[model samples]
Target: MPEREPLAPAVAATRLAVRRALAPYAGGAVVAGVSGGADSLALAAALAFEAPALGIAAVSVTVDHGLQAGSDAAARDAAEACRAMGLEARIARVEVAGPGGPEAAARRARLDALRAAAAQVGARAVLLAHTLDDQAETVLLGLARGSGATSLAGMSPARRDPDGLTWLRPLLGLRRGDTVAACAAQHLAPWQDPHNADEAFARVRVRRSVLPLLEAELGPGVAEALARTADQLREDDEAFRDMIDETIEDIVEHAEAGIAVSVAALAANPAALRHRVIRHVVASEFGVSLTRTQTLEVGRLVTDWAGQGPIDLPGCRATRSGGMVVFAARA
Candidate 1:
């Protein structure tokens, strides 16, 4: 085999990241998501070079939301770019509509399409090109909304879905500038998405204005610090989940209508664990996340039960009965 030429530093960095991420899936097929942006283009290029050498079949899946003029053309161009790098490419055009506004809806639609596209090629893993900058923005958004630990944890580098598909973000440690430099080194022309510049979107505002301003005031490294905080919080979240699982196993019971938790166990726990237990029970049994206030109300049933009536939750009703905090399905 002919020896490949030396790669530029930025290109080498991205390829190295992708190579490491692909280590566990050497013999498996993967779907590389491309949006024609610098980040994804660099990712696709890296995958093209790395996957084949590791005996992995990598295909590029470009999802077109068709929300803007010439979106189809853009998708085609992205696919062609992947093909140029010797990767099999496919375009999945999806209609984006649902709750949580356009951005969230579009993301949901895109992931669904990507999963379907992966199924077509028998791939079990999807690669996303989210960078460290993206992670910082997510943390900032979580802080703004006063969200819990889960939201502040940001995106995981790798996660598996219950349906069997795995999501991998190989470039999570790299900055966005690294991707642009990588594309330049690889001689790839990425489509510049206009929405990225429009401050109308919250993420764009965070990227363009909020982060930069924070960096200036904080004397740099603000984004990196936020990303580090997310990493630590993710570790903490994993540990907390383990503790919750063990505690729930001991305190939970099957009820006539739903599940029940022992009031004795709830009272024995510290306040933090007590609140978390209340929230977890509702989320797991009823498939609804309670707000902080709702969780506290549920806890109060154990800590300060004054013969109050059943507390209505989103999908269930919590009642104190027979020394048990019972969560029954709402009729």
Candidate 2:
């Protein structure tokens, strides 16, 4: 009998990555979010291959945003591909309607659909196919927005959202070309979304123009560098969050209308930690994200307090009273 060839390198690499990502969720059901794109198709294929060995029942979910023509058919085809891999599959048709633009609205709707699908299937985690290139683009977007460390940290490998659904991005360390090669090796024809090549979208422009420009201008490894920067920033942000949580427990008090933090404590900490604590408190209490200017203005009530009356903030107001900086609900 003729000997069977070993699995292709790209396929082996993808399966190894998926296996490592699913290790923690052993024996639990997992859902792969497939968009019929090369990245997601590779992810779905790898999950289908690795889940059985990990004792996980894998399911593929395709979300149809209905933005473009034939979207539903594309979603159905993705589901069919998953089924062909011997995994359960589902299609989630979501209505993309919200305040944000089409891209943002579509993303929000797709996430909601994925979470709902995961819950329905009793899956403990949903695997997403956001590759290293995606992370680099995210960092670039954050830089363009002049965001802080948390925003520049990009996406985490695994995160449990407020709704308690665990989201996993197993391909964050893999390159986009790796996924494309994996799909080719598996003989899986991926659907190319028109939006991906549309220059009107900021992400598409970044993917098509800016990234290539950077790679050309500065040689290579720009994406890897950006991804590394995100990884490092994420580690720092996690540590800072831990410190903030501990400090808040000791120094924060429940106010009549909102929350109060000790002015002395705020002033004593380093500037970075102090600012983060202030922002975290406001976000956690009032569900408002303070801009850098707003956060600094509030920080002034602690470090640079004089006889200032009250600083109006989004959804709340900050006032310096005695030894505490009180954030109260705006009347």
Task: Compose the digit string of candidate 1's lDDT tens values, residues 159-264.
Answer: 9999889999999999999999999988899999988998899999999999999999988899899999999999988888888888788999999889999999
Model 2, span 87-118: residue lDDT tens: 89999999999977998899999888888888
Which residue ranges in model 1 land beyond 4 Å of their true spot? 1-6
| Superposition TM-score, candidate 2 onto the true structure | 0.97
> lDDT score of model 2?
0.93
Return the lDDT, model 2, position 213: 100
